[model samples]
Structure formats: C-alpha cells, structure tokens
Target: MLKPFLSSSFVSGTRLIQRPLYYTKRTMSTHSHLDDDCIFCKIIRGEIPSFKLVETDKCYSFVDIEPLSEGHSLIIPKYHAEFMHQLPDDYLTDILPIAKQIAKAAKFEQYNVLQNNGRLANQAVPHVHFHVIDKPNTSTGLGLTWKPLKTDMDSIKTRYEEIKRNL
Candidate 1:
C-alpha cells in the first residue's frame, strides 16, 4: 500500500509520476517492486515505451536516450531501490550478468560500468540502474578525471577497524 508523490516530470515521451521521499520494504511478488511514481518502474510496467534491449524475470534493459556513446545502455532491476546498497541480495544476482551480455552483444572491447547512488553522485533517477557506457575510444564514452586525495594512514586504519567491527 504505497501512495504516489505529488509532482510529475516529463522525459522524452514518458510521464514520470514520482513517489514519496521514503519507502518501505515488503515481500516480493509480481509488481512488488513497482514504484508507481518511479520512471524506471513505469518503464518496466510498460507505462512508458522504451527502445528495449532485453527483459528477464528480474531485470530489464534498454538503450540510453541520452547516450554517452553509440551503444551506451542501461540495465535496471525490476525491484526498485534508490541505491544499490538498499537493493535485496536476490535482485543483485541478475544485474551484472545481464550487463555483461549487453556489453558483449554491443561488441564493447572497452567500457565503463557505472552506477551512481545519489544526487551528489549524479544519479538523476531515483531507481537503481547500471550504465554500460562504451569507451570505444577515449573521446566517445564516459570521460572523467579521478581526483584522489592524499590521506592519513592512521585515520584510514582507524576507519577500517570501525567498519570491520560493524561487519
């Protein structure tokens, strides 16, 4: 029993009805992951038309409308989660295998499998989706500069111990 969020956004030909800020977990069934307001959920449910590439019981994939390269694509789990950490273990199984299949079919010798968890990470959509961006050449696909900061080993060791304790 979920309710729709108040606002809507239009993308391409899809009308994305948004969900509330908070979500609760529930048992899995057909449409159990259907976030009525989520655009990816809507695509999964066929409320929006997509240039579909593949669909399995647990996942669906399609070409990215705004692709970084010629064959840039996305694979999303049928079960909706705003971030990967929130996604159930069962749903995690199919994602990478399917992405691999897509990369092979596209003949992408080099590529980037990108998933962003939040707005700060540039995740425009709320649902968890994995991007298979083709890096056929340096100029075509996802281009980025990885800026790494110098860190204190003592602080890093302390943080690692703290996290290990939680694990």
Candidate 2:
C-alpha cells in the first residue's frame, strides 16, 4: 500500500512539471505576403488604389483610406514584417524619417505617430505599419481616454526625488 502511494506521488509530481513552449519554426506565412488578398500588399504592389504621399527604396507612405483626420496616412516597409519587434533595425530607421515627411506634407498643426503590436493592442493588420494622423486641434481630431488616479502629491514628489538620486 505504501509503495503504491509513493509511486502515485512521484508520477503526479513528474506529470505536474511542465516545459515552457518556445516558437522555434520561423513560418514565413505568419508574416505578410504580397498577395492580392492582403490590403497592404495590394497598396505596395499598386494593385489597389492609394493616395500616394511618399516612397523610398524599401518603404511607402500613403494617405489612410479611413482617415482619422483629413491627412491620416500609413507608413509601411516594402519588406514584410508582421510585428514591430520583427522589423530589422535598418527598416525602422528608414521608415521614421519618411513618416515625418508625410506628417509635414499633410500640414497638420500637430500629429500623432502610432503603431500597435498585436491584436490586443489594436493591430488590425498583421503587417507592420505606422499611422501618421493629423491632429489639427484638441477638438475635431482623435480622442483618448484614461482613468484618473488619485495620489498624494507629497508621495509623488518623494518617489521622483528618489528616482532622480539613482539617475
């Protein structure tokens, strides 16, 4: 009876131990492909109509079809990167300056350059892209909401002072 009990416990412990899952296979399909089915790919291929703003050797900027404002545009790398983290450093560097140029061309008094990583972060498209939106005024543009938190000013000041000391 004791032997059976001990054996059961050992089996249970061994079974309870779990190995973490690692994504080893680099499936290229998980990234964007230049297919007719893909909207961004169509934009890249010039198959679908887009209001062209700027283009570089490895990137393209076009006005957003669904504009958050009058001058909303998207910046996409010619090479497919599904997520922002997956993008090569060179691709990142090349795209940002072009995005700034688009924002300037739109003549927005203020602009918001935004990107989302995953579905939970509001990434509608798997293909990596940046949204350069015109925010002309506080009113008539995109709005953001945040929950207000109540905190003691003295405590906040103390925390900032401590962080500054370490810096």
Top lDDT model? 1
Q: What are the C-alpha RMSDs, in order, of all predicted structures?
A: 13.2, 19.4
Candidate 1 residue-wise lDDT, 1-167, digit = tens: 43323222234566654423212342236658679899999888878999887665667789999999988999888888999999988676666766787788789999999999999999999999999999988789999999987899998999999999999
Tens-digit lDDT string for candidate 2 (51-106): 87665445667888888889888988766767888877756755666666666656
Query: Which pairs clash (backbone N, Cα, C closer than 3 Å) in model 1?
Result: 17-37
Q: Which parts of model 1 have CA positions greater than 4 angstroms off?
A: 1-29
TM-score of candidate 2 on Cα atoms, chains taken together: 0.64
